[model samples]
Target: MACSNLGHTGVTYTGKEDLRETLYELCQSPTITSPTGGDNVAGYIDGTEFKFYKSDNLARPAVVNALLGKAKSNYATVYTNRADALWIKHYPKMKVKLMDQLKPTEGDGAVGVTLALQTVKKWPRQIAAIALKAPIPGGGLHAAAAGLSKDLDLPPGSRKKGLARALRYYMLATYSLVDISSAEAYEGLKNYVGALLVSDQGQILAAGINTGSFRHAEVSMLLSYFRNNPTATKVPENSVIFSTLTPCKGCTGFLSVTKSSNCVIYFGQEDTGKDGKVGKKISTQLSEKTKAPVGRSKEKLPGEIVPDDTEDTEGTGVVAMGTASEIHKVQVDKGLTSCMGTGSIATQIGKAKHAKEVLRSGSEALIHKMLRTRATDAESEVKHAVLTHIGQWLGTSRSVE
Candidate 1:
C-alpha cells in the first residue's frame, strides 16, 4: 500500500540483526578517535587499513532498520540479503562528507549536530511558543500549521507546508481521542497571544503526510520523550491492547500497542506557551474511547497502595502481573470473538472462506492482505476502522461510542 508514500521507507528493517552486529564492531573500533575532529584518520582493523567515516553513516541506517522492517531490492528481481550493502554502494561517496557535517562540535557553534540536546532545548520551547503566541486556544490552528510548516522547511505555496502546520496542532489536540481540552487550550493560547500568523490556505492533509515523512528526520526530536519512559519489549500480560491511528505526516495506520495496564500515566502534552501554562484540562478521551469491559474491570480493582505483606502470595504484583488471561481479556475487549480474530484479516484474502472451509486454512494470508489494504486509508479512518474491526472480531456491535 505504498509504504514509501506513508513514510515507511522500509529501509529500517533491512537485515537489522546483521546491521546491528556490524555497528557493534564499528563502535568497538578506534574509528571514533575524537568527538571533536574534522580530519580524516585511518587505522588497521584485523590487519586491514580502515578509514573512519561519519558516525551517522555507520549508525543511521542501522537505527532506521531497527524501526522499520527491510527494504526491497530495486536493481534485482530477487530481494537483497544485506541491508548494509545499499549504504556501502550508493552512500559510500556521501558518508565522509555527511559525517564531517555531523561531527562533534566544539562549542555552542555545534548548532545542527548533537540533535538530542538540540531537541531537548527546542521541543518544549516550540510547544510553549505555539501556545503563548497564538490568538486563541483552538482557534490558533494556523499557528500550529505555520510552526510545523517552518520545522519541515516546506517550500512556499507547497501543499505539504500547510498540512504540516495543521498536523502539529492536530496531533497534540487529538492525542485524547475522546476529548480535545488540552489540545484546544494549547491552540487557544496561540490565538490569544497574537503571535501566530498563517498565510496558507487549508491544506492540512498534504501537510500531515509531509510531516509524517519527517518522522525519520526528527527521530531525535522525540529521543528525550521516549527515553524518559519505559516500554515493554515483549507484550505484557497486564498490557491492554488498544489500536488507534495516529497521523504523523504521511503515514497513518493501526498502532496496536499497550499503555501501562496498572497505572495509566496521563501526562498532558508539554506546555509550549512562554508563560509556562502547561496542562489546562484532564479529559478521559483515551480511557473512554478505547474503553473495553476488560479495562473497566481492571480499573475497578483497587490500586496497589497497601502496605507490603510478605506472607500475602496474591499481592499487588500478582494482580498487576501480565498473564494470558489478561491478554485474552484485552483481546476480547477489542471485540474479537476468537483469539485469531484479533490479527489483521487481509493476509487471508483471496482464499476460500465458507462454512465448509476451516478458518485456519488460509487465515494468515487473508489477514495480511486486509492489513495491507487498510494501511493505505486516511489516518482517522484507519484508526476507527481498526477499532471497528477489532470490535467486530470480538462480536461487538459497530455502534460503540
Candidate 2:
C-alpha cells in the first residue's frame, strides 16, 4: 500500500495522530493569508504529498494546471474550503480536461484530482441536505449525529465497550447513507456494506462503504487508512475492525496482503452474492495462516444480553462480545420496532423484491420499482437504532424530535 507523504513548507508530520491533528489545525488556521483575498485555502493530494496553494480565491484552472505540469501522476484529490458555487462551475471543465490528459495505462497512479469542497458557513445546510435525503424519522437523528461528531466523549473505564458500540453505530450510519433504491435495483441492500478501522486505543483510523463495483468495503477502508496515515505500512496490531457484513474473498485477500488486524468482527453473515460464499472459507483460511482470531457475533435481537459465563468457541471464531469481556446494556428508544436477521425488515424486503425483479425483468425494472416504492419507515427505524446505541455508549440520550 502506498501511503501519502504529508508536506507543507518542507514540514512533514509523522504518525496517524500527528497527521490528523495537523490536518485539523490546517483546516482551522486563519493566518495562512490567501494571496487573492478571503480566508479561502486550497490543496491537492497527488498520491504522494499534499501541496497547499494560497490564493485570494479557490485554486483557479491556471494554478491547478501549473501544479499538474510537474506532477508524476495525473490523479489527485483537491481539497478546498472555498465558495461552493465557484467549484460547482469550475469542476466539470477541470474534470474534462484532466480526463483528456489521463493515460490509458495509468496503473496505481493518481487519476485526477477529485474536488472535495467544504464551505465554513454551509455546514448546517450540508447536514440539512443529508437529513433531507435520509428517511423521515431518521432525518433528525442523522443531523444530530452530524452535529455531535466533535463532541464524542466515551465514558471513563468503559472506553473499550463504548468504542465497540461506537463502531457498530458508525457502521450502521455509514450503511444508512447508501442509496437503497439504487442498491436494490443494481445489487441488493444486503450487499451495500460498511466497514470501520479503529486503533487499539479506540481512535477511528478510517471508514469505507462498498458502493462501487471494484472497491469492497474492507479494501476501501484500508485505502482510506493509507491515504490518511500516509506513513503507515500496515494496520497496527491489536487494532479492531468492524464491518456490516462478512469480508468477501477479495476483501479477505486484500486484508491479508495489507497485514490487517487479526480481530475482525462482522454484524451480518455473508449474503448470497458472487463473492459472498468466499467470506467464511477464505476467512477461516486466513485465520489459520495468520493464527489470528476471526470471528462473528452470535445472532441476537436488540437489547438481548449474553450470559456472563459465555465463552468464545474455539476455531469457529464465535464470540459473544467482540474484543471485550463485559457488554454494556444499550437502552432502546421509545416507539422503535425491532426487525429480525442481519438488517432491518425494509432491507430484507428490498433484497427479496430486487431478486424477484432481477428474475422477472432484469435490473432496470427492479430499479424503477424500488424507486417507486421507498421503504422509509423501516429505514428510519434502523437509523434510530444506531443513534440510540451510539448515545447509550456515550452516556447520553438521543432521539429524533
Q: Whose lDDT is greatest here?
A: 2
lDDT of 1 by residue, 172-275 (tens): 22121111111222221211010111112211110000011123111221221222222322122221111112111111110112112231112112223321
Cα lDDT listed for each candidate: 0.22, 0.35
| Candidate 2, 168-250: lDDT as tens digits | 34443333322222232224324455555644443445556554433456655665665445466577665556554557655
TM-score of each: 0.18, 0.33
Any idea what lDDT model 2 has? 0.35
**Which candidate's TM-score is highest?**
2
> Which residues of candidate 1, in runs, are more than 4 Å off?
1-224, 227-401
Q: Which 10 consecutive residues of model 2 have the lowest summed lDDT?
A: 122-131
